[model samples]
Target: MVSKALIQEISQLEADFCSALSDPTRLLIIYSLADKPHNVTELTNELDIIQPTISRHLKTLRDRGLVYTVRNGSSITYHLGDKRLTQALDLLRAVMRDRLKHRASLAKETKATINA
Candidate 1:
C-alpha cells in the first residue's frame, strides 16, 4: 500500500509529465525524438524552431528524466529515456480518438434533432 505522501508525490509526477506535454512544440520534439536521436542543430533544422527554444524544451525533458542524451564528438544527441513512453503515447492517442468520436456523434445527434 502506498502512503499519502507517496500518493502525493506520484500525483505531482503525473502533473509534471502532463506539463511537459502541454506544449505542442515539445510534443512534436518528443515524437521526433521517438523516431531517432538527434543533435540540437539537427532538431532545430527539422523542427524549424530556434535553437534556444529547442534547447529549452530539451532541458525540461532532461530535467524530467524523459530523455537521455549522449555526446557524439562535440554534439549531443537525445533519445527517449524510457521504452514505456511509446506505450504512454499510444494510450493518449487512443483516448483522444475516443473523445473526438464521442464529440462528433453528439454533434450529429444534435443536428439531426434540430432538423427533425
Candidate 2:
C-alpha cells in the first residue's frame, strides 16, 4: 500500500503537470520541443510568439520538471525531460480520435432519427 505522504506527493506532481499544460502556449511549446530542442529565440521564431512570452512559459515548464535546458555557448536549448511526455501525447491523440469517432456516430444517429 502507498503511504499517505506518497499519495499526496503523487497528487501534487499530477497537479503540477496539469498546471504546466493549462496554457495553450505551453502545450505548443511542449509539442515543438517534442520534435527538437530549441533555445528561446528559436522557439519564439517557430511559435510566432514573443521571446519573453516563450521564456515565461519555458520557465513554468522547467519549474514543473517537464523540460530541461542545456547551454550551448551563450544560448540555452530546452527539451522534454521525461520521455513519458511523448507517450502522454500519443494517448491524448488516441482519446481525441475516439471522441471524434463518437461524435460522428452520434451525428449519424441523429440524422437517421431526423429522416425516420
Candidate 3:
C-alpha cells in the first residue's frame, strides 16, 4: 500500500522535476544536450549563456535527475539523464506550433473580414 509519506515524497519530486524544467534557459540546455554531451564551455557557447549560468541550471537538472555529468580531468560533460526528455520536448514543440498556426489563421481571417 502507498503510505501518505510516500505520496508526499512523490509529489514533491514531481514538483521539483517540473520546476527544473520551468525555465527557458534550462529547456535550451536540455535541447542542446539532446544532440550530445557537452562541457560547460560548449553549452555556454552554443546557448549564448554565461558559464556560471549554465552551471547553475545544470546543477538544478542534476538534482532533479534530469541530467547526468561526467568528469574528464578538468572538463565535465553533461548529458540528458533520460533521452526521453527530447521526445517530450518535441511533443511540446509540436503543440506550440499548432497553436501558433491556429492563431495566425484567426488573424488572417480577421484581417480578411476587415479588408472586405
Find the 10 residues in a row with the least total lDDT in model 2. 13-22
The C-alpha lDDT values of all candidates are 0.92, 0.91, 0.90
Q: Which candidate leads the pack in TM-score? A: 1
Reference-based lDDT, residue 84, model 2? 88
Model 2 Cα shift for residue 18 (angstroms): 2.3
Model 2 clashing residue pairs (backbone): none
- Tell me each candidate's RMSD, in Å, in order: 1.4, 1.9, 2.5
lDDT of 3 by residue, 1-116 (tens): 99999999999978887898789999999988888899999999998989889899999999888998899899998988887888888898899999999999999999999999
lDDT for 51 (candidate 2):
87
lDDT of 1 by residue, 1-116 (tens): 88999999999989998798889888898999999999999999999999999999999999999998999999999998887887898899999999999999999999999999
Task: Please give each candidate's TM-score.
Answer: 0.91, 0.85, 0.84
Ranking by TM-score: 1, 2, 3
Highest lDDT scorer: 1
Name the lDDT of candidate 2: 0.91
Model 1, C-alpha of 114: deviation from truth (Å): 0.5
